[model samples]
Target: MSMRKPLAIFISALMASSAANAAEVYNKDSNKLDFYGKVVGLNYISNNKAEHGDKSYARFGFKGVTKISDQLSGYGQWEYNVKTNNPEAMDMGNATRLAFVGLKFADFGSFDYGRNNGVLYDVSSFTDVNPEFGGDSFTKEDNFMTGRAKGLATFRTSNFFGSIDGLSLALQYQGKNPNPHKSEDRRDGNGEGWGASTSYDLGYGIQLAGAYASSNRTDIQASDKNGQTADAWNLGMKYDNAQLYLAAMYAETRNMSHYGISNNRYAKKTQNIEIAAHYLFVDGPAEGLQPSLAYVQSVGKKLDPVSKSGDAADAAASFKGGKQDLVKYIEVGTSYFFNKNMYTYVDYKINLLKKDTYTSATGVNTDNILGLGLVYQF
Candidate 1:
């Protein structure tokens, strides 16, 4: 009788535990998971010295948020490419983009640890369309944080200070991996960086935003040689209405240092300013036809460095370092929306610069591009 009583007690505890576990999963107000991604097809024809690599690709991602309590929760995202040319993939060679997990508290803020966008890229997003697929904008020209691979851990705080009416702040930590080269290159090893930004909405589809970032790393071995600290900063504003949209961004480079090559180190500091605006002409006269026009300009300048170098090579290569004299672009495109989540576009872009230093055609010489593409989002 005594043994049976104990057995009954154990069974009851097991049932209670199982019930609690099931309740958590099917809870009325728990954290939830969402999936999002897109498939992209592109046809790029360059009028310059570059070649067109036409292809189709898709990306898939998952995001989840779970409520731990009334004031705290956990969130994470994992994203990767579904299809791509083997060598065309970016980051980790996995076709995977970002994989990170973090904790979130209502008024305290959030912290994430894993592979993610650098502070400069995060800040850059505030300035322009961030056309990962390719568009002509100033953010696209900066080159420092444009196509970057960074391994990092970061944290962000909520708008406790009310710096802006609706502002939030975040800090990032990026460690530099060293190249087994010279001592000047050694300083680039085990580097660290940080950033800050604020975003606010002024009502009626208008917003203001800004961001900054810096990093130190070993000079990546390349044609141009020199190793020094590298960093960038940017500020931008954006606005949108039913028929028109505008975006502008300004960025500066402290040194000509990136991927380990610091050739223009003492040459000069640089800045890039870009602006783009689009106006809708037609909504949908046909079942799937909407047209728009966009204009983009990318401008740059070199500032005198604090140090003076008498070498003629220093004077010539240091000032322009093979970047570009200037670039301006105009585009007119039509978007056919299948629904709210899918569309196709054909945009013809023209370069208005007189210089031929930068060309898209490698063997040939052209300065224009006609692109046709389709996009599907979820």
Candidate 2:
């Protein structure tokens, strides 16, 4: 062909190739990475008005998955809190929560390590539908359950026995650093513990799950007893649909000591049972609303009264109270979700049925609490 003809054909081909390349980039972007974050702020009133305050937190996160091959791929997630506010008071800048890194192996399992909520807290969250505020709501996550340890690690399975589809198992390991200054700090750098849990979806929007975990600490002290240890476990079930959800959970804690002459001496136990329900509605199809309610009852038997005492020794002295059947709490809470990412909540709790109080080592009933707040999550 003539040189001029060849040059014209080349220019046309180049234009067509550019258009094709643009189309390919748009289509292949399905595998591209992404990032997301949220900031939540709210003000609330408490039973003791003096305890009322504002709550705000900033969350930043990143997630991505790359397909290495047909049956193999890589996935990861990193999330950190940019802001932590004081709900007990009008203070800002507290501590970052839930910062972790996870790796996934398709069809195999996944491993995650770093600062993450404990398995106990995870189970509690799975059951609670109501929003939480400061120390008033059970869904706020008790210190013993939500606190993160430094040497924490978790592993989860992709599936179970090739059947029971959508079923997975999670194993967790946490190292504790017991600080003499902290009252409930169970993270002992020397003491460590591990646990495993199994969960499965039954299809049709329903799920069943259960988990058992036990941790032992060497420097643990109870009453006047040193080398004290505790074991915990949780069981739960859930049902869900486009309209409603029902969840129930049971958890227990048992204490043991090695110094005591009596085999079961210095041994104490605490049990918690909770139930929750959530309902969803479409006001006009364009807008939606979700409402939820939950109740929790905690009972203790032969519980060491020392738990409430700031002094470990004092708490230990109150450990064995007049009646082993002492100490209990009943709580109820509700929340309304205006949308998937924003909501408001209210909660009431009674620390009734106490065999002893901090003032009376023998036993005493405590005060009640009421709380209301709002939250937004992304």
Candidate 3:
């Protein structure tokens, strides 16, 4: 069996999902290295003081691959991000976004371990293609196996063991991170967890995907007696072709979605939905321009009533079983690409959630937001 076909497919898929247009820096003796980075000048205008400000950032990463043999290969990637809005003397809020290494066994599958994206992102990513903000229906960072996090072992296979076409599957396991600091947010910590995802291309640029993840909550997280475990599931479909893209997803979570300032409260149950569409002009004066529209909403059910006393016992005692809207907005945007490595975009989020007691007490932002950005990647 030839390794050329499977290896090419794998590499193509990886590049399609990458945020940068990587440039090959080395390709000798079956070892290859690529360098990629992006700089973005961004700002947001909103009624909420916290949300209105400069949001510029700089990100860079490297990817390397080595062909060990006809049936084996090794690969690794590392990415870092730093906020550029602050002064040089202040803390820039730097962080590592991805750092992982893996081995691929030609037509069988690939296994990797380290800080990486959660398996559930496979489905949610379909609708997360807006110019600015869009994936907030039910996905969040450092919230169990729902988004990006630390300590994950992932195994993925494509083409269904080399027999079926356009089919892929993935399985993941996460180690416990017992964040012991009491002052820190507990939502960032989690216990043992596992996840699985699958996707199939039905042909003609249509695809279907689904994923599920479950994890145990830390001791401090469950101290309030809300729930001991967090679980989430998502299903999505998308159509992508030469000139148009459309996607939609529906998701549900139990004891996984966070609320309130510092994410101090957890919702008992939540339901979310997102839909997005974009069209590109391949020719004429509108060439290189794309317009986007999207709708996203998330609702929490059986929420614990908040208390003004700031006492845990009082808040728990006042729980009369409530429900509230967490996020609701419509996004309209457009991006014009000067070339493959640079673009400018403007996105506006039309807030739909009414400003009321529930939203005010929970610190939910109901103000409309306007974002403008210019990006250069290579």
Candidate number achieving the greatest lDDT relative to the actual structure: 3
Best by TM-score: 3
> How do all models score by TM-score?
0.69, 0.69, 0.92
Off by over 4 Å in 1: 1-29, 47-50, 82-94, 130-148, 158-164, 179-190, 219-227, 256-268, 279-327, 353-366
List, residue by residue over 120-230, the lDDT tens digit for candidate 3: 999998888878979888788778878888899999999988889999999999999877456545668899999999999999989999999999998878876877898
The C-alpha stretches of model 2 lying farther than 4 A from their native spots are: 1-33, 47-50, 66-72, 82-93, 133-149, 176-190, 220-228, 256-267, 283-287, 305-338, 345-377
Candidate 2 TM-score versus the reference: 0.69
Model 1: per-residue Cα lDDT over 286-360, one tens digit each: 544545554544443442221123242443323323444344666666666555456688877765655332221
RMSD of 2: 13.3
